[model samples]
Target: MQRDYFDRVHFWGRISSVTALAVMLGIPLSISLHFGIWPQAAGVLNGLLKIIPMFWSIAVIEVLTYAPLLGAGGTYLSFVTGNISNLKLPCAINAMQNAKVSPSSEEGEVISTIAVASSSITTTLIIAVGVLAFSPLLPVITAEDSAIAPAFKQVVPALFGALGAGYFSKHFKISLVPIAAGVLILLVFPALPVGTLIPVTVIISLLGAHLSYKHTQKKEKKRQNQA
Candidate 1:
């Protein structure tokens, strides 16, 4: 019997997810058993207490926000693969855009999957090559006297600047208030814990964008009425 397409995806996704989770758990479990030692209960609880309270909300928010954009396969693969924001997502989006595939369509799912796969492959190969070359390249890249080391440090900011310029140019109106708010929040509350800060910033940004969109709609309607 032919199953629905999503049913198949869901089936595979669950199997893959479970297998991956098992493998991840297996490694530490094996080590613990081999060493005849387990992590301290208090240590585990303290770590979990700090992390879960902060991260659980952010995880929920990310799942709610990104799941519709990333279909079943992409979502599953992305969760396993990580780097959704900076790498996988942008590559998938660019592939979909270049192919003129609507994100909501099956074709877009294939395109996104292919794009992320290719990106992962390329990243892996690059890392492999870097590993092979590391002994020779290490001094050149890491020496305090090496100019290249400084350049590597700047790469992240340069990337953010380029991406920020592109995004903000298009979304300046909807983004400006949130951007300002985020900066102010950071400046005023430098001690804000990461777990609290991320979700708060995201909420602020979402609210700002929504209000901006509504304001623009209202302005358009007013103009149309006057016309």
Candidate 2:
């Protein structure tokens, strides 16, 4: 168990470290390119120099908050591992028929569940705070001219729309609430303060999700009665 824990810790630590580095490097490079801060040939080197200190600062902060970060990283790692392990379910079942113990045990289930919850809570809080705090700096980094800055602002909404579309494609019937909620938010956004937008968006999404759940439950019950 200790060995397995160590392996998982090392694996996820490396993964997060690499991901953070790539993001730190990529964002500054992209911003520099967007803003024409350097000639294309020198952009990467300049961006690297500019971003290294910022990345180091973030690393230091994460190390100081290692407890929460590790809890979250471990949760995600366990989830991914569990998913991969489950994919081998058919073979595992076949082996289990002749074996003394099953590969999928109660303890594994408990561990995965706990890891997922803890990781999710910590990671979400960290990301939410980070984004809020860093939002102002984004324009500074990415802005080339006033025109370009406004264009960059469209990226977030476009990305969100694509995500919403993917979600709707997977669950078509439940999509309308989110669509309507988004429309309402956009309609009211001009009058709303920027500070209120995030909370409003959250409320709308939550209400949409609740409505979708109730709708699905009602449909399921109707089908059951019909049967």
Best by lDDT: 1
| Cα error of candidate 2 at position 131, Å | 20
Off by over 4 Å in 1: 1-4, 33-52, 55-57, 93-108, 132-140, 143-145, 191-198, 222-227
User: What lDDT does each candidate get?
Assistant: 0.76, 0.53
Model 2 Cα lDDT, one tens digit per residue, 1-227: 35576566668667876776687679868987899885565766787899798667654543443223224333334333332122222222223333433234433433433445454566567668768998887667566776567766685566456545645666676567656765687786657643234444445666777887999899999999999
Weakest lDDT window of 10 consecutive positions for candidate 1? 193-202
Q: How do the residues 1-227 of candidate 1 rate in per-residue lDDT, one tens digit apiece?
A: 12477788889989988998998899989999999999999998988998796578777876766666666777777777677666676677667767888778888877877887788778778778888978687777788888777887786577557666766776777767766787788899988864456556667888888887899899999999999
Candidate 2 Cα lDDT to native: 0.53
For candidate 2, report its TM-score.
0.33
Clashing pairs in 1: none
Q: What is the TM-score of each candidate against the true structure?
A: 0.73, 0.33
RMSD of each: 4.0, 16.1
